[model samples]
Target: MKKILTILMIVIMSTALFACTTQSNNEIKQDLVVGLEAAYAPFNWTVTSISDYSYPISNQPGSHVDGYDVQMSKELARIMDRNLTIKAIEWDGLIPALNSGEIDVIIAGMSPTSERKLQINFSDEYYRSEIVMVVKRNSVYENATRLIDFSGSKVVAQRGTLYDDLIDQIDNVVHQTPLDAYSNLVAAVTTNVSDAFVAELPVAESVVKSNPSLAIVKLEQGYGFESEESDITVSVGMRKSDTDLLNEINSALSQISVEVRNQMMTEAVLRNNESELTLFGLITKYLSLFVQGVGVTLLLAITGTFGGFIFSLVLVFGKTQKIDKKRDNIFKKIIKRISNGLSTAYIVLFRGTPMIVQAMIFYYGVKLITDISWWTPLSAGLIIVILNTSAYIAEILRGSMNAIDKGQMEAARSLGFSRIKSLLYIVYPQAIKNALPAIGNEFIVNLKDTAVLSVIGVLDLFNATRQVVGATYDTVTPFIITALIYLFLTGVTSIAVNYLENHKAGKELKDA
Candidate 1:
């Protein structure tokens, strides 16, 4: 057991070391690190083909990203005499990534809204697009020419975006909670979760073309969203401190006329449309990625759950320690009190907070304090899972220990065993038998929750599916594949737990 644990630890540490050893912000002065949501079509999207206009996404092997933003970034890199490196970041995480020095700029069709301007600087607009509504093909809003025509309809948009804010413009519209991705928005509209969703013209066109059941409603000029220049114009985002770099980027963008920008968008749309594949074709083509993602997801789940169980054992033991008032010394008493307090506090802190927030704090916070290459996304994710899972397992263990008959400990003590020995040899084994089911359930939960780690770029099952969606523009089938994989994992775990419980019961009957 000790040897096995040591090997696991070594494997985890080695993976962390390799994952974190990427080029830091300061080391990439000659390289332009551009961040964008590669899932968005026309503006940016992931592709497997390596073409003259495509660049490989950082850290994603065998995957390349090609879109209008990518082409523009390439031209900007050429003009600035720097190599362009693209990173496919989630939309909500793009600004934070730039601010945290993870990427040099955001070219993901982001606008220079006032809210975003306060955190980072922006270059001149590269692409201008009008807002449009995407609705069901035969829905009432499909033929509506103005925003007021859909006054009572339920509308939604991607969260933290200018489009989300624009949803309230309709006089009596039902504004649904914003989702995180355009693919999600597409799902919402197609499933009738919302009557319509706000989108840019090109984005709406891309989605509508792929999904024949969907259609676009182009509002008349005066009836559209009332907006400012910042809302409609997409620009490159940079850190506020990089004024010189920002100025150079703006100069490069200025040299490219509006006609050239339009030509690039046209080319990107043509390419994106040409590469579109059927849902079944996409699943079959990307089966290898899905399999790889399963391996990663299982690795994280097993290591995290096992590590948490080990740590929680120590914590439960510490919290359940008995202090003898007459026999224990002052130092012993002090240590006991401190350990109990710390155990309780740790349990509360981790269990009370969300895992996603913890992931962000660890990933970006460590980067701010230290430039250590060993703090990779996988390592951070594992740490979060261990810490978070430890708290729940501690509570579960405590309950299981309490449920064990007190007479068992007393009986063992009378048989020439010390209290510690009684607890470890006699009490712990039964407690573990009772707790095994809960531990297995925790493993299942970890399998699903690890999907949240994709925000920090851990390529688990969900992230792999997102990459497929980005490449194929088919949202439904990739997600269906991911769901089926999760179901299989949890189902297997459940069956294993049940088998162990039944086997243990049968052995106890034989002993009796």
Candidate 2:
């Protein structure tokens, strides 16, 4: 059943990936990849058909891309006549992907804040929305004017947003965790992950329309925030050096109007007032669920760690000791190839290439060669994590082995013990004692690294919380709930590691 599930997951992931990434063959010069949260309705999202809209959305052929940014990009593409591509990346990776030249333009609804400007350039502001609190319908916070009304209350906001920064301005409110996107913000609130969340008007309006169970708490004038806070202007982000792309995007923004942008919003958003929402609905309402994606990440970390360990030990054995036999001779040569290869290429390749590429290859590369889906999300995710982890673990184990005094090996050999026996009994035990802290450290990192699994669609704590934030449009609560969960997991891991260290000291070597 597990194998079948893994295979099925791989197939589904591959199909979704291909559908999302496969490009139409409209001729062009350069591929202009625009990154955005496609789940942001009225701005961008994947729907069954463009025909589903009450009004046509910016003339997009399919039901995927719409809203101000979509319209502007399409209109600009017509002007440039280059193949415009949309790459839906997480909010956090947007600037980095652009800086690394993975994408040409960040058409996501990002604000050109002062800090963000240092890393990337931006086109002029295209669309702006005001920040507001989303709460349960007619709740105490509903129509409650001013920050004082919600003082001592919990508030959540998406990380790195102006809303997050603004949360701190409130003197007494208990700020929970900061989420990464609008979607998780809603999920946070809807799931009672948070009490209320700060979001822009556009997102809040859409959230209320999509989930009728929620209410939008409009701040009365003088809401104790900057005018800029109320005006959450979103613009296209570009790399600092991409002057050409920046200029092209600016030109595109000039031709668009406020009216056309709003029209797209009306068509894309479906009004709903329900209490319960599906993951899909919550995801569409908010794009942050991707952050909490989990199962694959955990699988990736554990398997990667274990694989790296076994592979490392074998390599270490071949490198450190000598063996003699006809079969041993063949094994020695094979080990030599592996050892030398590990030093030269394997280390460089696995460590050098982006994990994302490796993951994509593991997940979808099956389509090119065979019908069999050889990778499960967890297995595939772990394969890369392990490949990367093995390099580090291999180096650590090698170092620890060397740290064992050479004399110990000599004495063990002189005492009539085989090389393998000496290594198993005398060497590895001490090396592991030395490596315990490092191993513990790695596990903690592994826990956090789980967030990366969101790309592959594992809804772990972060991804799950992100869904809540996105759906509730309440960023703080969901994030707080999820963050606490992460902290708890990490804390438990730390306790376990400490216990192991103490146990080894008492039983094996004395003194932890």
Candidate 3:
């Protein structure tokens, strides 16, 4: 038992230490770190293999990023005389990452809109293009050239972007909930979930090229949704304090004339790879990505569950500290009360909120206080799951503790065992045994729930599937594979958990 506990402790500590050490060599190296959503094609998208035009994504292993954004970033880094380091972040996280010093700049094809200018400074326009709508190739609105023509049609856009806000401009339009990624927007339109989705010209072209069933609707100049000049121009984003860096970037942008910028974008479009393979072939081509994603998913789920179980033991002990009114002194009562209050508060706080909300708050909130160089999505995700799971598991253990006969503790005490030993050796073991099934269930729940970690850019199974979809614009096959992989993981886990239960039961029976 001591060996087992020691092993678990070592594993937990080692994992935490490793995560802390995975920080980029920002302090030691002169790399020009940039953040972007590699899921966005033409602008940026994930690729399985490296090419002369592509850079390996810093965080997502076995993946490379290539697009107009990458091209611009590479040129800027070259002109600045710094090596390039790309971090593939979620769209919403780009600004936060820039402001938090997670990356030096955001070269994610973000527009320098008025609202954004308030949060960060921008370099001169790197790429400028008009907005267009993507829809089913032969749909009713295929040949439509005006925004008014699509009135009453379901419109969607990427969340937290100018595109989503523009939906309000369509007269009598059914504005569907904005999706998280451009890939999702493509999927939504392809599946008829939305009649059309707003996108930049390059994005529209990229998707249309990949998806034969989709087409682009370029509204005439006076017929499209009105926008500010800044809204139409994609610029490099930096923290407001990065005035010097911004000036440097603008100088680099100036050196590259309009012809060069246009040529770069043209090359990126031509370089963007689109899969023409059947569903089975697509799966075969991207099977490595799926396996890698599953590995990350299982690593998080298993480590989180085991780590949570161990941490929950501490919480359970805190909450279970007895405060007998008749026998306990004032000091003892106060100490017990404080411990119980903290434990109760932790459980309530985590359980009271959604995991996704908790993930955003915890992940970004930490960035403000410390050098989160070590805090990749995977590391942050592990910590979040462990803390969140501890709360629930603590409650589970507490209930199981309550179910333990009070006489058992008294019996141990009668045999000359101290109160600590009585609980540790006698009470805790039984409580854990009784709570094993619930713990197993939590593991299963976490396997699915960890999908939310993708919002922070953890390339778990779901995020990996999104990357594949983003690349191919064929959502069905990737998701079908993802579903099957998850099903297999959970199914195998269930069997293992049941086997442990039966084995433990048999051991107890034999001992009796």
Give the alpha carbon lDDT tens digit for every residue of 404-482 in model 3. 9999999999899987899889999999999999999999999999999887879899888888887777767788888
Deviation in angstroms for 110 in model 1?
A: 0.7
Instruction: Tell me the lDDT of candidate 3.
Output: 0.87
- Model 2 reaches what TM-score against the true structure? 0.58
* All models, RMSD in angstroms: 9.7, 13.4, 10.4
The local lDDT score (0 to 100) that residue 289 gets in candidate 1 is: 72
Q: Rank the candidates by lDDT, best first.
A: 3, 1, 2
- Candidate lDDT scores, in order, read 0.86, 0.65, 0.87
Model 3 off-target regions past 4 Å? 1-29
Residue 191 lDDT in model 3?
82
**Regarding TM-score, does 1 or 3 come out ahead?**
3
| Candidate 1: tens digits of C-alpha lDDT, residues 426-492 | 8888888899999999999999999998898777888888877765556788888889889999999
The TM-score that candidate 1 achieves is 0.89
What's model 3's TM-score? 0.91
Clashing pairs in 3: 40-44
Work out the TM-score per prediction: 0.89, 0.58, 0.91
- Cα lDDT over the full model 2: 0.65
